[model samples]
Target: MKYTTMEQLLLTELVGAQVINHGGIKVCLRRSENIPSMGGATFDHVALFVLDGTVVEWIDHLNPWDIKSITSLKGSETNLYGSRGAYGTVLIETK
Candidate 1:
């Protein structure tokens, strides 16, 4: 839920939502923007966490449309994970 100033700016200023790459190393400012393939990686590839604490690599493969409902965590929000969360994290709650 916490984000850096830049991350917040991207979310508010961008015309569309943002997405992260497979390795969680890059952030796409707009939904239409394409993130290059990371060798078999799925689209919207960020660290995915469910309510149960299970983590997933990419949400696109599971269900492309599901990305819309995910809550993206970036910057300082990822501090808890140290290096693994350097890029960012995504939390998805399944109903």
Candidate 2:
């Protein structure tokens, strides 16, 4: 399917403005909406991440093997983060 990402992720269900981090840590960008503003949005405006259940400001370093699963939430599904998930939310389950 056509896609976009902090890297790029693949999902048949991914819609317009949707994103996925298919390569490496970029996978955490899943569900990040594509909104090309005048100033452009930063990664923080792309998606909020939950690493091992702890909400982190950013992923400093991540080992592929440490990742157990990756889930993305968008639109109304992101209410849990308040405005943090306005773009989307990436839930990273690590080992």
Candidate 3:
């Protein structure tokens, strides 16, 4: 996997995204689209991807031991946790 760059995220407006804790991990959420198209989802997990550019805190949805990862959405292959047309969320935590 490739590490995300500050320029890519910042220029992409993926900063200050949100994240959710599932199975005790924090994962980055992305859009869900069968075809690679623009103007899709608002990114369900921006909070995790932009961690390198900024530090985020969702006290209500994370734990101290939580790790981080780019879990892709099933079928769609997008950087998300759950599946497309379903949850389309992810769970990454601190390793």
Q: Count the backbone clashes (under 3 Å) in each candidate.
A: 0, 4, 15
Candidate 3: which stretches are off by over 4 Å? 1-61, 70-87
Ranking by lDDT: 2, 1, 3
Q: What is the per-residue lDDT of model 2 for residues 49-73, given as tens digits with 9 covering 90 to 100?
A: 7788787865545644455666778
Find the 10 residues in a row with the least total lDDT in model 2: 20-29
The list of candidate 2 runs beyond 4 A from truth reads 1-44
| Residue pairs clashing, model 2 | 8-22, 9-20, 21-26, 21-27
Better of 1 and 2 by TM-score: 2
Q: Judged by lDDT, which candidate is best? A: 2
The digit string of per-residue lDDT tens for model 3 on 1-95 reads 22244223222332332333332223343443532334333334333322323334332343333334423233454333232224332333344
Q: What is the TM-score of each candidate against the true structure?
A: 0.41, 0.56, 0.23
Q: On residues 1-95, what C-alpha lDDT tens digit does candidate 1 reach at each position?
A: 43343334334433344433334423443233354533444445334343224655433334332233456666788787676665456555544
lDDT of 3 at 86: 44
The candidate, 1 or 2, that scores higher on lDDT is 2
What are the lDDT scores of the predictions, listed in order?
Answer: 0.45, 0.54, 0.33
